[model samples]
Target: MPASPSPLSSPPPSPITPNLGLVCITVGPEVRFRTITRTRYLSFPEEERAGVLHALYGDNIGRLAGAAAYCVAQGIRLYRMSAALFPMLDLEGDPTGQRVLESLSAELRAAGDAFTAAGIRVLVHPDQFIVLNSENPDVVRRAVYALSFYGLIMDMLGFSRSPWNTILLHGGKGGRAGELAAIIPTLPDAVRSRLCLENDERAFGPTELLPVCREVGVPLIFDAHHHVVREKLSSQDDPSVRHFVLAARATWTPPQWQVVHLSSGIDGPQDRRHTDLITAFPAAYHDVPWIEVEAKGKELALSDLKQRLKPTP
Candidate 1:
């Protein structure tokens, strides 16, 4: 395990230190990893679901645990873990997940311990298909199941039910923020405690999600690139964003880590598409605790941003 941070002597985060975050994989020589796809997973015979899921889930766990170690070594403090960690672990047809988790309890416990022990904050973003606010009853039901699964996994991995170990999801169906907020209390403690909402490129921006965030008592992760495109800003550093940043900060529980997603654009004029590397970071983020550098470059982009952010001697 990497070194753990000391107990806070003052306010939870006295210094304006935003730890750089890497999304999913490591690009350079240090590490790289992946998980089984649903299509490939289902291709296997139904009779083999037990062994197959064990292998796939086990492999994913191993990869994540390894990535945690890599983060500690690289001094990267935040990581957005892939949402596909468990595949059919939540499916009603496939109930072998509990057994698989039991079988790998030792590995799971150790990996979870390592992540916490390393003092590395871990989070996950479910795919776009999951819209907790969707009016479609079936869609909402499935979204609830998927989210509950994330909470369960976090618990199994020994993650704290706090914003630091978040299960991030976009606030889709933007206009119906109330419906989203109404569902929060009904959710199990696992999902309720760790769930966070983020502003998306078009549907939900800071203006749309802020009220829901406060109402639901969840943190709001301001995605800089998304906000730039959503609001037609000159750049992510637009002065206007400072207001949004401070407002978003107020939504978070405080001092744990106010997360923001950082990415560059592929097209000019604040395109919603992500590029290989980010051009700049919001000065407003300096006081935040985590900025997830989610670009095509992955960890490489994160490393580049860190280098550029380093103060001159």
Candidate 2:
């Protein structure tokens, strides 16, 4: 009988590769950059509003295109768009806003096309000021407006207002999951369709927010650092870590990469503040495709984490 083939005859298993990316901006390579909004333009003469709006939107769109190009070249497939990209959108429904959107439609479509061709995924996270569950009606309205603005941006990017280019928000106003649940149906379909809820340091954790996400038919973005601080789950091997990680992933539909935000703590009263670089990654995060580093160093931090994750020669 022929000798059994040696185990070494088989090719070594391929190394585990991660699909990783940075948040809104990039550094070092310095491809992604920002544009000034010039809110003061809104104060200019009404007759000049059209010109001002066009200029602002045009400049920002150019910068956005640059950002997309950077992602394509760097193999960074995920990007979180900045909330400030369209300052005029804050004045939603203004004739000027409509003009700006109309004027930039082609450019926006081109940028979106480039992104799609490069296989880059886009996401938007509204600022903390947006709180859907706030008791104040005005606050809630503003929050909804912000979501609408983000929805419009995605629409302009030639993207369907769907979870593919999702809009992420944090759970706010602790224990008010009922309020959020009630408000979800009332939001414009444009906003609700792309919206996702995330756990924050003060208000919600995976355990508390998961049910709300499921009830609203949205996905949850598990912030590992926030969960560790809020739940005090310090160990990387904590059973809860894997449990919640899997739970968050379950909220997303197939073909959508489960997104998680990563950050480290600094010296502070709470020690929960985000540091410039991630010093360590929780082992429980294994197999996660898209991890957005929320460190102050942005892309620099992501580079550091990628270096750490590389297999030793």
Candidate 1 per-residue C-alpha lDDT over 1-313 given as tens digits, one digit per residue, 9 for 90 to 100? 1122222112122255468888887666555555566687778887887888888778878888888889898898788887877777777677777678778988988888888898888898888888887989999898888788888888888999898798888888978888988987788899889988889887888888898888878989888778888888887668767788888888877745688777767666377677677666666666766788877777767766666665544
Each model's number of backbone clashes? 0, 0
Q: Give the number of the best model, judged by lDDT.
A: 1
Number of the top candidate by TM-score?
1
Clashing pairs in 2: none
Candidate 1 to truth, TM: 0.90
TM-scores across all candidates? 0.90, 0.88
lDDT, candidate 2, equals 0.75
Q: Which ranges in model 2 have alpha carbons more than 4 Å from their true place? A: 1-16, 28-39, 235-237, 268-270
- Regions of model 1 farther than 4 Å from truth: 1-17, 29-31
Candidate 2 per-residue lDDT, tens place, 1-313, comes to: 1122112111123344556766877656455443444567656888987776677677778878888887776678888887777766676557577667777899988988888888888888888899999999999988887787777778878776677788888888898889988898788877888888898878888888998988888888887778777776654446777788899999998624688887766652136877777665666676777888787777667666676676657
| Model 2 / residue 150 / CA error / Å | 1.3
